[model samples]
Target: MLPEFPMSRQCPYHPPAGYEELRKEGPLAQVRLYDGRTAWAVTGYDETRRLLVDPRLSSDRSRPDFPVLVPRMAAAKLVALVGMDPPEHDVQRRMLIPSFTVKRVNSLRPAIRRIVVERIEALTADGRRAADLVPEFALPVPSTVICELLGVPYGDHEFFEEQTRRMLMATSTAQEAAAASAALIRYFEELIETKLGEPGEGLLDELITERLGRGELTREEVASIAMFLLVAGHETTANMIGLSILTLLEHPGRLARLRSDEGLAAGAVEELLRFLSVADELQRVAAADIEIGGRLIREGDAVYLPNAAANRSPEAFPDPDVLDLERGTRHHLAFGYGVHQCIGQNLARAELEIALYELAVRLPELSLAEPVSQLGTKPGGSVQGILRLPVRW
Candidate 1:
């Protein structure tokens, strides 16, 4: 019998214990999902990249054969940019590319640094020595940055954050997930309508004026896109920030080295991304017959590409288990591979670089306040992260 898919992770920083065994089985191995349905788990680095770029692999969530890790995800599927296939995916991706380009992200560096500093100051205010970095620092830095960039009022973060948590939580029921998604879509729709009447200088406004006004996209489509960006823009980065802090504090020598050498921050961020692989897996389905890694995938067959396993593959990274801040390789699948790769990756890179560098320098005494084992982690979900990261300075 095939092992159940998404084997639990004993340690938050590492992949599931079964991942190495699965990889040993071969690049692609059959694994049973939560529903007792089988899917191909792609564990090899080269194979995962090849499959990601293969045109025969479909990201469409609406496909009946599409694998849903948890029951809630079935109801939460909204075919936005990530879920879209080419032609449509290419078109929509191109529209948003300009905003996330290296130059554009570079231009926002000052703002990102400001946000990071603001969060750090807030966390350390009143001579505070300890804090749950998740809410005080990690969460707000990206949330505020994304909110500002998307024209969504940051004041309403509590409402949307709750909704996003519900939508992404693996424990959520189908109806609960659907309701949270619907609430977000409705919120974006209202925001779009308001921006239509009174414009602002943000991505949402630009999409409305350029795409919606030009008839290239409908209002609902724009809203859906906004909701997708709003959720993804913050959640992943926030988790990465929190986990990066924990990982760095665990290795004080590396943390000291990073704090002393500002130039190493960029490479450190990349290393952290590859090491953590925070977003666990990328789900897809075979659009047609495809053969790779000595395995045949028939049309409509579901596929799971676990980024954790791929990033840690010894074949791809020498000393893959060791955390080397100087490992400057950017080939890791942390931001994913191929065309559907994260649109805001440049922005994410900038945020992580700034946030980590600032925290290390500003609070040289920062350390974990509690045992790593005592920390709560998010339950089974598409993404994996610490629920609350307690820290002291």
Candidate 2:
């Protein structure tokens, strides 16, 4: 019998133990999902990179054969870039590329640094002995940056954040997820109209004044893009920030090195990203028949790429399980690969570098307020993140 896909990890920082057996079996192997459907699980580094960039595969969630890693993920209609294929995906991605370029993202470093410092001050503002890093620090840095970048009112963050959480949680009922999705759609629709009339100096305004006005994109498309940006902008990076901090805390030697040497900051971020492939899986559907790993995948077949498995494959990096700050990790799939690769990666990289550096410098004596095993994580979610990171300095 084939091992099941989407296996739960015994430990939060690693992939499920079954992945080792699967990897040893072959690059691609058949596995059953919770829905009782059989799909191909891509586990090897070479196969994963190939399949991610393969044009024969479609990211379209609307496709009948699209792999639904979790039932809740399939409940919503395909509206974001993750669910769109070429031509459509190409057009939408092009419009938003300028704002996320390395130069543009670097320009916000000063502001991101300020946000990090401010959040740290706020975390200790009341002279509290301990604080939850998730909400207080991780969540706020990216949330504030994305809000300021898109001109979204930071005041409305709580509502949208909660709604987004519900939508992504695998345990959420279809009805609940759908309702949250509807609320976000409604919110963005209204916001788009407001930006249309009196444009602000943000990505949303640029989309309105440039893309929509030039007929390059429709109003609904702009709204969908905005919704995508708002959710993707903060959630993934926040989770990563929390996870990175926890990982560093677990390795005091590395943490001490980071504090002592500023040059290691960038490489450390990449290494942490590699060490923890936060997203459990990347789903795709074969748009046409294709042969991979000496096996033929028919058109309309589902494929699931377990990033955690691929990232940890010894074939890609020796001693894959170990986290080395000096490791050559530029090839990590934490941000993904191919045309669907994360567009906001530049922004994320900047946030991680600055956030980690500030924490090292300002809170040199920071330590977990509670035992590591006592911490909670979001179960049954695509993005793996700490639920709460209690810490004290």
Candidate 3:
């Protein structure tokens, strides 16, 4: 029998060969999390999609009756858009939606592609042959893209990077992640202040000034939203670049497809996000009452919708385990559904598309330097990320 995996450390991304066994067992499986709390993991595509949009499934965990699975290390009062239900959640999400519109995000694509190409060019230059792509390229690519859009100073990339690193490292204790998050919040607060005083041209500054000009949002609200945008903006795309590269390296045929079909790069990124399924799990509380997967969820019951598992469910994608770049790319829920879908997804798509295109065109000879198993994965925390990826052309 497989050992019980906890709700906290249960990494669906850390699956072994033939991991489909877990998804096939059922749509809803009980997981014993690292904290020993039982979490219901949803695996069906429709089920997961429905769960995300259901008004009955609440994102707020602060309800005294509904206990959260893990310490809410990332937020206070959980004002996060992802951690909310309608009305309140809608308002918070709508506040950031304008900044992440396709038009706004598309304007950043040229700049994003420039950064990806420059980084890749730098990586292969001046007699330096091989370097860990994560730090040198993968991590910074998205970070630079987000910083540019947010108008946050790139001078603080090192600072943002350190905090992001500690934020996701496997061994970082809850206190460590909490400390890093606090530091991030504090840093954003200072940045917001500077943006307020200087009023430079970037998303953060624009957002602050716009909201302050209107009576819609306060100074603190602007800071909090800016902080959320920065963290979510960079963190998810960073995982996509690394994990997508690894997935391509593991499947040369797909990588070759990306090389030949430049137009397919966007869909390729979506497929990779689905196949790699790096976002892993989401936490929510039942808002009222709902029956899902034949189980009744009571009001205020904590629930976890495992995005990784649902991506692999056969009922959703025909031959679900297969990573076909040509498959139904639009159906993937790597971005959640309804009001809570990632606001920065359009920007993320541009970033991922550019990164994959650059990697495919530039590093046609690239392959893993060692067995994939040698790489480490963090089973818990926010983003499902690899510790190191050794690669060479």
Candidate 4:
């Protein structure tokens, strides 16, 4: 039996580089959450994937004895959209997925390209030996594009992004984090009101006029959807951009190939998403007693599927940790697997392709100022990727 882990000291997002040590011991491990709760982490790929799509893994922890990492109120509020079981989750996810399909994002490709191009050009024009690409380029391109796609005004983005950062990081206190979430709801609350008065030619507008008119969503549901998009679209893409830069710079040969051959760009993004896998571990709880990896799980036990670990699972991928762009990178689970895979994956790909293509082509000399081992993560527990990535053209 594995030893008991004290949760009060563990920050799953910042677990040490040797995490696979614990994971390899078994698919299931007793671990500590930041709040010191006793929860289980499910680390095996086959078993983890099964549990994610398992109907019994309840996402709603609002029940008095709800299964989760935090208290009912906080967990439900943070994961309300992604955490709900189906019928409830199915309807909400369906309403949002159409807006993020490849067709829709492809239509916005030229616009994504334009946004990416402008930022890279600005960085190149500065002509510095090193550039803080995180804010200068990575952060803004996705922030503004998603806003336009969602029909939010540019002025509102700065505020939204600030509040999101606070919400994502541990930089803020619990009270501070709550306030930021409330402020965002207020902003989205106001946006929903405006869209009601005069709808525009964007996803959120169409969602309101067409769906709400047809009784597809409630007013609160609309606000929740808008809130979900704003948080996910910006932060996930921002990290991808920042992490991809770090990934390429960490491997100059791959960077050179992308710079020299435009054909490598698409495959490279997939490879980077696979290699970096910044989304890291995803969680689910066992609904009832089930046998996995030959061990029986009791009902209500929480499971943590470390996608980063699984993507690097040697059994699943040959020599898994290597960053091989030409390795026919199709089987990786960066976007996840089965029913609960990322809904915004298509949009994320579009944004990454546009941003990365422009950066590689324009900044032919793009390289990192510091090694990957040295950078710190952004505060708050929400987003964790290569935090401060410096680059040069």
TM-score ranking, high to low: 1, 2, 3, 4
Give me the displacement of residue 203 in model 2, in angstroms: 0.4
Per-residue lDDT of model 2, residues 1-393, tens digit only: 666667766666777788888877789888888788888988898899999999999998777777777777766543678889898898889888999999999899999999999988887777866788998989988999999999999999999889888888777877887888888889988988887777788888888888889998888888888888999898889889999999899999999999999899999999888888886688888989989887788898888888888899898999999989999569988778999999999999999999998998889889999887688766644578778899989
Backbone atom clashes (below 3 Å) for every candidate: 0, 0, 5, 6
Please report, in order, the local distance difference test score of every candidate based on alpha carbons. 0.90, 0.85, 0.73, 0.71
- Evaluate model 1: give its TM-score: 0.98
TM-score of 4: 0.90
Show model 4 residue runs off by greater than 4 Å: 1-15, 64-76, 126-129, 371-374, 378-381
**Residue 150 lDDT in candidate 3:** 84
* lDDT (tens digit, per residue) of candidate 1 on 76-150: 746789888988889999999998999999999999999999888888889899999998888889999999998
- Tens-digit lDDT track for model 3 on 1-393? 332442233333343332345465667666555556565667677888888878777776456645444443433322567655678778877767787899988877788889999999998898665778888888899888888888998889888778766765555666776777778778887887777678888878777777766877777777667667777788778877887888888888989988998999878877877877666667777767888887777776657676776777777778876888988567777787777777788988888898988888998888888777777665554577676777888
Candidate number of the best lDDT = 1
Candidate 4 per-residue lDDT over residues 297-377, each given as its tens digit? 778776666666677677777876778777767677778776668888888888887787778777777676776556766
Candidate 1: where are CA atoms >4 Å away? Answer: none
| Candidate 1: residue 247 lDDT (0-100) | 92
Deviation from native of the Cα of residue 82 in model 4, angstroms? 0.7
**lDDT for 72 (candidate 3):** 39
Which residue pairs show collisions in model 2? none
